[model samples]
Target: MELSPVLLYGEAEGMVRSLQSFPLRDTGSGGWLKQHEYIEKLNMQAILNASAGQEEMIKDLLVTHGKVSSLIRELITVEIWKQKVFPVISQLQDFQPRSTFPLYMVIHHEATIINLLETILYHKDVCESAEDLVLDLIDYCHRKLTLLLSRCSAGEIAGQDRLLPSSASETSSLEELKLQAESLEFDVALKCLSVLRYITDHTDSLPLSITTRLLNTHNLPCVLVELLHSCPWSRRSKGQLQKFESGRWLSVPAEDQQKMTKLDGQVWISLYNLLLRPECQQKYNIDGFTRALISSHRDPHRSAAEPSGATAISQLFVSERTGAPKEGADLRAGSRSLGLHYQREFWEMEGDSEAPGEACVLPQ
Candidate 1:
C-alpha cells in the first residue's frame, strides 16, 4: 500500500526522535537496519514530490523537528564506517556471509542520506535549520572533494568504467564487492559536489564561519578550478565522449559535446557564489596563484547574459588581478593554520563512542 501523507510525516517524526549514531562495528544491527529502510522509502517519496511539484512534507517535518543536525551526524558516521570498517571486513579471511547485500547496503547508507539532503536542502529554511552542524557538513564536503581531486589527478576515477553490479549475486567475491564499493564512492563524491553547491547558495545568510571555511580553510575555489580542468564527470572512451548524468554515463553526440553538463554548471555556480558574495570577497585572499588559476579559464567570447558564464568569471579574475588587497590583510597560510585549530577543537567534541555489545549479523 502507498504511504499516506500522515503516515509519512509520522515516520519522519519517528525517525527524528530515534536518530542516534551507530558504531562502525554495528552498522547492520537491527535498529540501524530499520532506520536505513525508512530513509530509503522517504528518499523515494521526497523525489516523487519534487518531480510532481507537490508539497515537501518530509522537508517540512525534518525542519520542524530540527533534526537536520542529527541527519548530518548520521551521514558523517556512516561515511566514517565506509572509510574505516568496510576495508577490514573486505580483507577478513574468515568473514564469509550468505550474501553481500547487507554489507553493500551499509556502505550505501551514506549515499542515501546525502541524496535525501540534496532533495530537501533546496529550501532556505532547511539550510537555516542545520544550525551549527553546518560546519560538520562543510568538513564532510571538504574531505570528499579532496579525495575526489586526488583520484582525478591520479586518473583513478576514470579507470573504473564499469557500472555498479545489478545484484548481490553478481558481487560474489569480496574483491568484486570492493570494486562496487569504490564505484559507489565516486557517485557519493559527485553528490557531495551538489550538496556543497547548495551550502554555498546559503552563505549570505549562513554564519561567517562558513565563508571562512570555504575561502581560507578549504580554498575550495582553487579546488574547483582544478575540477574544471580534470572534468572527471566527462571522459573519453574509444575516442567517444561520455558524460555522467542521471546515475549513468551516456555518450555525447557531436552536436552536444560542447554544451555544459549539470556538473559543469554546479562547479561554476559554486565559484560565482564564493567569489561574488561581498562577505566572501572580503574574507577570500586572492594571491597570485588563485588569480592565475581563474585567469586560465577566462573566455572573452562567452556571452555576458549567461548566468555564471565565463564572462562573469573572467571579469572577477581581472578585478582580482588589478584590485588592491582588502583591509585587514592576512596570509591564507595563517588562516589555514587557524582553521585547522578550530576544526580539531570542533571534532574533539564529537567524541568516540562504541556500539552496545552484540553479535555482528546481517540485517534481516
Candidate 2:
C-alpha cells in the first residue's frame, strides 16, 4: 500500500504556496477587517505547520506577514509553550515580589498570544491536537492583562506607543471574564481584582516605558509628552507647566502605589457588580443613565434613575492652571485628571418631521 512521505512530499506546502504568494488586491468599501482576519487565520495555519518541526515552513509564514505586529505578537506568544509551563508559572508567582511582577508579565504575555485560540481549538485546520495549548493561550491574556494592570499602574504602559487604552471595551469584557474566571470556584486571583479596579478607574499611570508603549499603540507621537516636558518654563509663564508636560507620571500625588492600584482596578468591578444586580436593573433607563452617573453618590429621587436635579460632570478630570502668585507660590499651573469623567449634554434639533418623536427611555 502507498504511504505518506516521511517528510512533506508537496502535499501541504506546495499545495498552499499559490494561495500564500498571491498579492492582495485593493477591495474597496466593505470593512476589510474580515480580510485581515482571514489573512491572520492563514498566517496562524502557517505557524501551526512550522510547529510541526518545519523551520523552512515557519520562515515562509514570517515572510508573508512580517509587518503585522499583532500577528507577530500572537505568533510568538503561541509558539513559546511547546513544553509544560504551569510549574514555571507557579515558580515565578512564588519568587521575589518585585521580580515576580515582570516575570509573570512575560509568561502571561507569551501565553496570551492567540486571543481566539479557544474558539479555534476545535477547528479542523490544524492536524495535531491543540486543545491544551489553546486554553493556555486564553489563560495568558487574562493573566497578563490582570497582572500588568494590578502591579504596574498606567505609568508603565501609558506612555508607550503600544499601550492598550484604559477604556477599551476589553476592560468591560474583563469584568464579564471575571465571572467566568471564578466559575470554577477556585480562589479568584487577587491580581484579577486589582486589574479590574484599575481598568474601571481609567488608571493608566504606569512606568514611563510601559505607558509610552501602550500609548504608542494608539498612534500618538511617542514624543508628545516629551515635547510637552521640554517646553521652556518661564518666570512669567510658570503656571502653565503640567503633569504630563512636566513628566509627572501620576495625575495627582497618591497615598501609596497599593491604594492607587486598588482604586484604579476597582472601577470595573464595581460597575460590573452594579450592572449584574437587580437593584440597578430596576432603575436602568437609557435617558437617565448619563444623569444617574453624575449623581451616583445619592439615591434616585424619582422613578427615574438620575436625581431630579440638573446634572454635574460626574468625574471630568482636567488640570486647571490659574493666575501666577509670588515666589514659592502655586505658580506651577496645572490640573491632573484621574478616574471616570462626568459630562452633560443638552441638545435642540430642528429637522424634517417624517420621524416625529425621538425615543426617550424614561426610568420606570
Instruction: Give the alpha carbon lDDT tens digit for every residue of 72-136 in model 1.
Output: 98899898888788887777889988778888888788889999898887677888999888888
Q: After the best TM-score superposition of candidate 2, give how far the Cα of residue 270 lies from its true spot, in angstroms.
A: 12
> How does residue 350 of candidate 1 score in lDDT?
26
Candidate 2's displacement at residue 74, Å, is 8.2
Model 2 RMSD in Å is: 21.9
Q: How many clashing pairs per prediction, in order?
A: 0, 46
Best by the TM-score measure:
1
lDDT of all predictions: 0.71, 0.28
Query: Pick by lDDT: which candidate is best?
Result: 1
